[model samples]
Target: MATSRLGFSFLLSLFLAVACSTVARQLRFVTVIYRHGDRSPIKAYPKDPYQESDWPQGFGQLSQVGMMQHWELGQALRTRYSGFLNKSYDRQEAYIRSTDCDRTLMSAEANLAGLYPPEGSQLFNPNISWQPVPVHTVPESQDRLLKFPLLNCPRYQQLQRETRQSAEYVNKTRENANFMAMVANETGIQNISLESVWSVYDTLFCEQSHNLTLPPWVSPNVLQRLKDLKDFSFRFLFGIHRQVEKGRLQGGVLLGQILKNISEAANTSRPQRLKLITYSAHDTTVVALQMALNVYNGKQTPYASCHMFELYEEDSGNFSVEMYFRNESGKEPFPVALPDCPQRCPLQDFLLKTQSVISQEWDHDCQVPSTSQDTEVIIALAVCGSILFLLVILLLTVLFRLQAQPTGYRHVSDEGEDQP
Candidate 1:
């Protein structure tokens, strides 16, 4: 009996040890996609007093408020990952990529200023209190993979058109017709549609955010409707009809790339040089990625909002992907659940669930005929061409024979082959 008790105690101890170790998994990597900080409205509606000259940095440029917003974000990041990241700046440990836009690039620089405040020998100038950390970017004209609102995607455009014609869309449009027309008249923009109403709202929102007075025609109710419209637009942009198909073409491309990075980071054989990767881009970029993940909250993501991917390695030789979103500057990032997934979702499960949305060749899928459709068209065209070719050959042969036999001159009239 004593021997039995001793064996059971040993087994219990081993089980406890394993359980504790499993709970203490290590964070292997992190990928964060954040919107650029506040900015002037990209453009103003017709007859709006605010213009390019109103902003010191010109239209669409990051403002002083924007810089401070990102600076705070950097501080938040540093605080959130204090022990997980190196105390000193390590180029090999982190990678940052941004859209090649003035606002996005500048936001990245500002965020880095807070994220990696120079310490020890890394500080170049004691008075400046900042160091230059490289923020890499591909020009907007050349970048399609990382940025959202991807242009020239024929498939996505077709999906958008279909979505607009969907019953839900038509109902919404009909319901909002009176309000939309009111906006068009008040803003003095002759052809303002649901798609373009955001610009007017954005102009008003930005001006209000900075405490500027608004036009008398605008009211709190008007602004609320505008905000609602913008939210609807984002949903329409990414999640309307055939949500999965739209995702596969637009945002899923980026999601797949991010998953690839997570898998590589989790691999034990790979030389884990990169601990963190950050994408500095627009709010649309954030919304599109979240929509593909099926975690979007159907609201416009606030400026400086960040969607983070945290990769973890468990003691049982498994990896997991955890997501969080920080849409408010003053608040902690909330957990974003993948559908039917645990907060710490297993990497294999993550891949399995997202596989349907992951696109292999985004451009090819967006531009050309689908493989099955193309095959049917090709077969039909081939059969038709073969029949046409035979007819052409027969006609040419008869003409040749007739010409060969007609060498002898024969008097011919317009009537009945000259009655010869």
Candidate 2:
């Protein structure tokens, strides 16, 4: 009886030890890339919500509500990673970044409010809102100047064009054509292009949210249709078309940057367990990065949706990366699982899994331009296009006025009008 009891106790201790070790194994390193929370409109369309004058926070600015959303996210993250990073603030073990947009920069700050608070040696003031943490970023236009995603390779542009002409794109064009025809018939508006539809949605969504008055024609049904258009436009930017090349443009390059940071951190023996990189940008920015990594479906995810990727190194020197998505109203983050990966994932597996991308039309050797050069191009194009567009609009307005003149002024041919 004594021998049996000893054996059972030994077995129980062994089980507990294994369990503890496994738990510790998971609490090693973590990396997260998330989208910023809700914000004011980036720009106004012909019929969009609260204009620059109407928005208290101004265009593309994060509001108080946005702050709350990020704060909640920070709280959730704090709980989830409390075991891995720390229960409280640890400056030596964490970093944060934003995408250099007003909303994103503010979002990072708000998130940090929940991420780090007074604890041990990390607290600076007792009654402060929170300790200050660095949320690094460059000029918004110069974000691409940092290197990885900033290649100016001609081959990449070629691949982008190829993707644009692919079977998927052709199908999308067909779908758009049908949808446009239907909409034109319904609204009695001819030539309803993507731009027109997108403008309609942006105006409605922004206006309605900020309590700005909608246009006379902006009914519920029309508003819904406009939203659908926006989703389709996002898919065009992300899933159906530009994902692989975009991944090559952004995440593929950023992945390299992240690896470099990790390698340096490991070599230097730094304890930055929470590499809390932040990106401050628009919805398209989120879509571009997500789709390139083959993650987003060809649909709109939502406002303030977040994507998190966690890296773990096992006791045996094996590395793993787990992915999770937190939309606004979820009880728990959804696992972004793959066929080969379960909940607790591997990094190398992620690289390998996303390697194929979605389509077969991507070029591996595209070079992204420096951020300055790209920004310069955008500025030049915008200036020239603005001038041209104004001229076109003015000319069209005049032409329309002329055509709309009374028919009585136009000479009527009185050939055989028998006054029926």
Candidate 3:
């Protein structure tokens, strides 16, 4: 009996040690990219009863529901990373960046309000529960990091043109031609294509969400069909054809920055002070990142959706990356695995798999080889070279004529003068 008890104690100690070691895999860093909360429609359809003035804060501004959505998201973040983050707001520990838009900027502020509510000595105002947390942004025109589907990319534009002509796109267009025409006629839109359909759907969806009475024509079935098209449009924009190259031109830019942050955090040589980096942006931003990662589900990313990256240092000192997506307010974020890699993807493997999508030279890659420009340059050079060749030939002919013709005492001049 004494021996058996001793053996049991030994086994218990071994099990506890193994469990502790497993639990010691510390999270080194975290990065979150989230869509801004709900907002008023960016624009209303011409035939729609609701106009810009109908919304309390005007067009594209955050609604009260939006503020609450972000606040709840912030609270979720606080709960998810309670132990990892400091109890009080620490400027050194966290950074938040938002696009230079009214909705996105406000969403960031609201999210921060929830994530770091003023506590103890940190409370500045007794009357208000909220404290100011700095949210950074740049001019919309200048911001390439957060603002996605960079329309300025010539190659990306070319890709869009190509996508339109693709069999899948053509088939969809052909199948939905009557539907699109009807929508265009109903909305008073002059021409409706896959790209423009989203706006109409967005207007209706926003109105529906806000309890506004949608037009009689906008039936439940119509709304559902519009949603399907909207999702397809997102896929078409990001991944219908030549997805890898598209990603390089569009989403890869953001992915490169994310990978860089992860790398910096993983470096054990440096003092790892920063814990969390949050990007408060739009649906397109979330989609862009997921598309780059090749993990995008073909669905419209809802408002206040979050995509998280957590870098962990394992017991063996190897770093791994894990991704989670939280689209719903009530449910936990589900794990998203890197393609051909485990959920806890090794740092090196994650980098290797994602390297193709990461643009080495975005500007160079975005440059579509302009055949017209090249042809013009070649033609100009040819014209100049031909003119120079003709000039040389004319000069040589003139010199030959002077030498061969009876050039007024040209050859015999010196001898004739001496003889004379």
Q: Which candidate should be chosen as best, given TM-score against the real structure?
A: 3
Per-residue alpha-carbon lDDT of model 1 for 9-127, expressed as tens digits?
99999999988997778888999999999988888888887877887777888989999999999999999999999978899999999999999999999999999999989988989
Candidate 2 TM-score over all chains jointly: 0.70
Model 2: per-residue Cα lDDT over 153-221, one tens digit each: 565554556666789666766777876676566545557675466755664576677677776666788
Q: What is the C-alpha lDDT of each candidate?
A: 0.89, 0.65, 0.93
Number of colliding residue pairs in each model: 1, 18, 0
Candidate 2 deviant stretches above 4 angstroms = 1-14, 47-50, 119-127, 145-192, 219-221, 239-243, 259-275, 355-364, 367-420
Residue 36 deviation, candidate 3, in Å?
A: 0.7
Best by lDDT: 3
Error of 3 at 171 (Å): 1.3
Q: Which ten residues in a row are the worst by lDDT in model 2?
A: 356-365
TM-score of 1: 0.86
Higher-scoring candidate on TM-score, 1 or 3: 3
Error of 2 at 399 (Å): 65
Deviating ranges (above 4 Å) for candidate 1:
1-24, 368-420
